[model samples]
Target: MTTWKDFLVSASTDAEAQFDRLKNRLFSRLDAKKPYKIVYYRGFGSPTAVWITGRVLRERDLSTPSDNDTFWQNLLATYQRFESDEVPGVTVRVDAFGKSNTAVTDKEGYFEMTINPPDNLPPGRAWFPVRYSLDAIVQPTGEPVIKDGYLMISPLYSQFGIISDIDDTVLVTGATSLLQTARLTFLGNAYTRLPFAGVAAFYRALQSGPVTTLFNPIYFVSSSPWNLYDLLIDFFRIQGIPKGPILLRDLSFSPAILSSQSHHTHKLAMIRKVLDVNPQLPFVLIGDSGQQDPEIYTQVVRENPGRIRAIYIRDVSEDRRDEDVRELIRTAEAFDVPMLLVPDTVEAAEHAASLGLIDPDTIPEIRADRRADKE
Candidate 1:
């Protein structure tokens, strides 16, 4: 009699067109008794998507192939619709890979694959490489999708983390100017957002690290509207940022009251909450110089100075000649935390590695990749 593991091996294949059919057939053979959780992440205008299906292993006699076979089948079925959503007039193909399997996304930008690594597969790490592409189209709204035509499925770590901003930081479009700030506060989502370049890369790199590392937990605290919570999550997912709790400003509180607090008072309050909940983990804070990052980080250093090992600030314009920059320098000086000013993410990563915050061995490789792209 063929074992369940043998059936799973036989079921693994590379035909993207047959992914759905194969998944369905395999799942139908399962008993459907095991509980599974379906997790998914998608990015806008990018051909990247992530999904994981797994059932919690309880102490049960799974020695029989039938017992475990059904579980695998059910897990595979859950991932079959990876790219089935229709993006009008555009066809997307998702390329998916497992240790022993490969597949592609359908016209609707979906793909499915089964991951059944050998039992000896390292217990602490799980990675999947996925890629896809689609024709570029300008939506009626005039938003253009740039197709770079590069397909790469990197080793996505099973563990991930995130640290984000608020106000114009993660929500809305303006953070530095007073007029735009008023608009973002009063109108909310109507203000729109222009995410910083290389933000997606930063998040993906953090996600690719080992789950048990000090920086694996992703964290975001912003003064933006809490109503945009789901939208932000989807944005990060589609962009390949790891998923984590987003701490947002409670609009229910009076704006006047909030203003009375320090510039970073609200963000600092939220950061404290994050530390309270996750006491031992270190965090990489992502923010812009326009608003309260420097101020909040200053306070964070004073309070739990050890928790934040790296802070990345995008150097947008500010009255640095004035007291703002001086104050930030003073705060960082007090903590002995090296504050780096960078035009983009690549520079930030380089600085971090140089400071021994991240692995130094990886910097040359990342720099080379940057050069290749530019050439």
Candidate 2:
């Protein structure tokens, strides 16, 4: 049952080992420092359980620690190889919701553990109080990183789920423009990074309805690598956006078969993984016309018919593709899926309201957020 990802992990582990040996031979003086940091990604699960993923690595950038964790610097560092070495063969323990799961980190220092509770927990957004610590016997230090991991369990009987792209649809990554994308990447911090106008309010309305308890799951799927996971989490909070699982690719510049897949392939796999996790929950796919979102979402609509509740495509005003997007619109129309080639967040929100997907009153919140951006 070996998978392509597993093969890639194995290959990457070998390459990392070779790099470490070479480093040790040249810089033996640097070996005195102990490894004591962990990079954990928030995970999601159902009402009765949750799953968490993380990598155990030493704090390599201890010289320039920031008040905000300096994720922007780490994000920039991801472009280089061997930024942080993985502590493999480490015994990691994860405890949450009165349950515990133990697993060993692979050669990549990555571990995933799922914890199931005794009963179904409360609906809406909830954190299971996750705590992880490396086994002292194998660790160089006893320090443990404490962070709250989020798991959004959609109301068992709620409406459709949402899996949207982040680059241009939610935040202005300028992904379609090379110069703009590089500038934003190197120059912008998470706090300064901008979300598209009204996107936050629209997403919030979708999560918490007019009655204010609707908890349909909303997921942010992006081509951005895992290095920016924390930054995106901060971006969601500062912008008043509804919180959900952020699934990102592992854009590790390594020799791996899994890395060979196009960005769209990675996204499609993640979307399908979400669908498999929530079998009964139909989805509303959202993305932009910036890149392959239109085409990728079209394939989803075709492959998984009737399960798609709707589709929303935010048009890139800079590179507005009428003919290309129109072709996608026609494709969605043929399948009877409600699709929109929207110019902005306000228009998308209004269209969703008209379709009874959200309350008509949600438009103001979206507009207010847009206005705040201008101010």
Candidate 3:
């Protein structure tokens, strides 16, 4: 009884419905299968809900990008980035010191809760442990599952701390170059990635230095989004960078600011937060010459006065930016904070050695690692 046009319309309607179903599935993928397993980011600050957060995702939806991934694998990784799954609207309970706090996940399947510690908490240990338990969920196939996760609390006690950038300063990310940066970001996974030569040993020496002692806290404050948290953690583990809180930019991907997400604002906000949290401890500012490190560190010195002991910026872009760096270096003379623009990791080590931030013997260790990496 239907005409050809009606048949075509019915078919078209069915296809649209199918597409809509697919889109909705992508949004609720983790929720439909399992209660999201919590992925915790290290939290700083204390006394108040020093703010703890982690993303929940289904196990199978997680992608570990490798530099050696084939074309298809890379494509899958790209999908993982754009179409990643998150747990949503579920309540999570966090337990610490016999007290519990509750929070509900966002549409992105992320949750945050600040468990209060006792009034007279001991600082003898660097880390205190907390337990997380998620509510049970039913999968489409009628399977039930429950997830448990743990978090560590870093207590503040160091004389001086180090806030370093990760992209170019610690890891050899091609951030200054758009094409190269995109290539490295999209194609490279944590395992396939590499660290800047001699950085690990240099940082370890600083951590174990006479100035700050063995447990000096190091905060890797990066402008990169939080989505790469696990990959960055693996990179640090492989490179032997000392364990510390890694504060990353929020990839909230908020529709309002996607067109103008300011990296400067994010990094600056984090640096200020860290400084504010540990008012008694001075910090060393470590960044690179690539983007805004020199400028930002200059501002920090100007604003905080004597709080920053030194600024060490690795010279990753010497050819075109020597004059720019020299200008920043010269300008730093106006402030009490010393700034060192080093040509190589060894040079930075030497400066730190001279300043007593690290041992003099660290210079030789850095040289050896540099030689080994070259070979």
Candidate 4:
């Protein structure tokens, strides 16, 4: 049953794709002699197969920012991020565990593939390096470009997994308001962008779980564009957030902007994929009430049933949205998953400790960190 809205979205999506193809063709012709690089996003997998995503783009002069960087420098870096020179139709080869796979970049210069190893990987949580090499024909004037991308393989049996959102959930992007979001994004560097109070401590505790060595995997699934990948990675490092596979969406000119429901489609699919790959592992879902996270996470609980351990939504919106999420909490409770809308990380930490998801002794550390972050 395709509604009128669906038909309109489909037609607009096609038009946007065609426009992107034309634009990419022109850029490819104009930037033939430019230096290029392969930018890899962190990937995740189990013992049998690995999933990876990356992009090939003409290199820009964006450098690491210092604390004293001028406003102009931040603005320029932001511009370079959005002014991407994507290289389409280039062949990329990925090799790991004595096996190899190949994929071609799409018009948006992005490539994704899943490769199964010849044999099962050793059972444990660790990072594997996947070597990526570009076809020489694309860069005929110089040596072939090669880079290593990392894939995190979680243990077959663990306490649980965590899937979280980025923008307003952990990092403060003021996502509910376009003007504030733009102000923060355009003028702020990794050092300047702020994460919610005590997010680092809370996420670290979750990663370590009740036992410090558990190494429960954490995944970030966000609706943010792929262009901000490097900035987000740097921000995570600066804030001491646990690292894992970051699932982001392409910044294509799609009809997604016109429909609120389309924003969470990518996020939901990515969360489901993570759950599907780790069938034996239950998960904790985390997001915020600023957008459609409550609605999306409720759907996840309904679909996965026993697979979801709990849900924690950070409260960042108004009373109306709070009530909306409260109703969603009731809806999720029907599936036996405890869903809480917390005003801060402390509340979530308390509930998680009560549930034995994290160690109770870590509560003091969380409080100290939260207080220090406010300074």
Cα RMSDs of all predictions?
Answer: 20.1, 4.9, 7.8, 2.7
The segments of candidate 2 whose C-alpha lies over 4 angstroms from its true place after superposition are: 1-17, 20-31, 60-82, 123-125, 137-141, 144-148, 254-260, 317-320
lDDT of 3 by residue, 62-135 (tens): 56555566867765664565454556777777666678787888866778765566766677555656666666
Which stretches of model 4 miss by more than 4 angstroms?
1-30, 138-141, 256-258
Cα lDDT tens digits, model 1, 1-375, are 987654544445224327645654554465233222111232111113223211111111212112233444433322332222122223333344333233433332323333332334333432434343333433334443222211112222322224677444434356667787654333322113334555545554554443225335456677664434444654555444555556554332233323446346767786776555445455567777776677777677678776666677667765553367556756776777666656666797677656545555555555654454344
- Candidate 3, clashing residue pairs? 65-189, 87-109
lDDT, candidate 3, equals 0.72
TM-score of 4: 0.92
The reply for model 3, stretches above 4 Å from the true place, is 1-22, 25-31, 46-49, 59-75, 113-115, 135-157, 211-213, 252-261, 318-320
Top lDDT hit: 4
Candidate 2 at 22: error in angstroms?
Answer: 3.0
- Model 4 CA lDDT for position 327: 93
What value does the lDDT take at residue 60 in candidate 3? 56
What TM-score do all the candidates reach, one by one?
A: 0.49, 0.83, 0.82, 0.92
Error of 2 at 82 (Å): 8.3
Candidate 3 similarity to native, TM-score: 0.82
Please report how far candidate 1 places residue 285 from its true position, in Å. 2.3
Highest TM-score against the true fold, candidate:
4
Question: lDDT-based ranking, best first?
Answer: 4, 2, 3, 1
Ordering by TM-score:
4, 2, 3, 1
In angstroms, how far off is 268's CA in candidate 4? 1.0
Instruction: Please give the clash total of every predicted structure, in order.
Output: 13, 0, 2, 0
Model 4: per-residue Cα lDDT over 193-277, one tens digit each: 9989989999999988997678889999998888898999999998899998888888765677557666878888989899887
151, model 1: CA deviation in Å?
31
